[model samples]
Target: MATTPDTPVAKALRRELLLVTGMSGAGRSTVGNALEDLGWYVVDNLPPQMLRPLVDLSRHTGDSIPRVAAVVDIRGGRLFADVQAALESLRDTDDTRLLFLDATDAVLVRRFENVRRPHPLQGDGTLLDGISAERARMAELRSQADIVIDTSELNIHQLATLVQEQFAEEDEPTTRVTVLSFGYKYGLPSDADHVADCRFLPNPFWVPELKELTGLDDVVADYVLGLPGAGEFIDGYVAALRPVFDGYGRENKRHATIALGCTGGKHRSVAIAEELGRRLSALPGIAVSVKHRDLGRE
Candidate 1:
């Protein structure tokens, strides 16, 4: 018998399907970016109607996109209803998950203000009015969300870490990890998985000689590590995180991020991030990478 579009083989190839939808100003882009970082094939602002077709085509192409995230938002114009249909279709298919990102109105407003971008519906009326419409339109979809996120309370690092926890290279032993160390002053790095604040640590910036050097430099690293509670903190911190890693390893957790932050992000946060990366990489398995968000800058 000839296989039909609804055949088992056709659905089997669709390894992972993620339907990305959320409020206009919520952290949809952030979620997409974070997933992309985790090795997913991400399509932003995909017309809602194209979702099923895209997934079908991906299957026919030998599943070129094993892990896929398609953004189906209000940008689809009249095709918005297709998002609802596509989501419903995927729910019936095996091996597919739908995630909806969301946040409070105040948080959405702040995000829009920070980005200085008009909401999708802003062209027709007041920004607030547009936001309200967008929210109303998304109400039904939000209710069906398998996972809902409140970005209002989460920092970039925390958000990234959450994404990594959920979707990293499933069976890969080696995955590139991005460790972002940022300062609270320069507005935290917007793409960190896990963020740890190091403001409590001694400040290398206070020392005239090390003030000009970053934590990457031996002088600053030495000064920061010699702090009163540095050793004790690292010990306790690692102890707390060890279980999480063990769980991730046992469960084959793919992507994960941990952020360390401090006042200047130049000294304490940087040092801690570096140390953390080193310790993490030393594990028998897994890969690690580190980036200091405020290292080069003042």
Candidate 2:
């Protein structure tokens, strides 16, 4: 059921052109990977200046692929703005979207540490310093985004699916909800614009028995949620947030992110994220997946 121009909202798949950009550690790879899964011809880390040329090349060849996604970022150096211009040039065509992935500084630090990768902007500075620089550099790109996603709390799998559901939509809602839980020491997640700190919740890491297990484990999940306000908070929080997501599903907002954090990220945040993901998935019109960022470190 490909959506066509005259088929109305119910039947046509407005041809999609997406420019994916964001913080380096903010899950751009994951988003690109998911768009690939959705059948978009994906190109990563392309310079912004080359966007129009690439699109022209694609059109000239008349390739069979109808959907196209490009991952362009600061790594493209001073050319990122060029890419934004190219996307804007196509905005009136009825099938173009610009998605910006983001997260908190803490999550970005932890992700870089876990992966043992150096920050592009750091060059000789500290990881946190590099993240700050990257954020500052991408400010303009963020403002122009048609869809903005905070990937701080999103796991790789969840980030991928979210890209697909949001940008790859035509008929049904296939949005994937990524739940990321990380530590404060690692810095906030580079992709999460909206953050929920659960540091006040009891720390399971201090408990000798639970130290070995991740928040995903049944024991950890139970222990974290067993706290006084934990369950109640999740219920009300979910109730409040549900409408936003549901509206996105109904209106088909392309890309979105919700991040949850805690002191260590291995327990309370992970448990709550997992719980939230479960609840989001049960909804009739939405798609969901869960990930715990800090769990991968261990």
Residue 192, candidate 2: Cα error in Å is 37
Give the winner by lDDT.
1
Candidate 2 global TM-score = 0.52
Residue ranges of candidate 2 with Cα displaced over 4 Å: 1-4, 7-14, 61-63, 169-298
Top TM-score hit: 1
Per-residue lDDT of candidate 2, residues 46-130 (tens digit): 8876766766666655546557787888777677657656767777764677888898998989999999989988888999999
TM-score of 1: 0.56
* Whole-model Cα lDDT of every candidate shown, in order: 0.76, 0.75
The TM-scores of all predictions, comma-separated, are 0.56, 0.52
Error of 1 at 142 (Å): 0.7
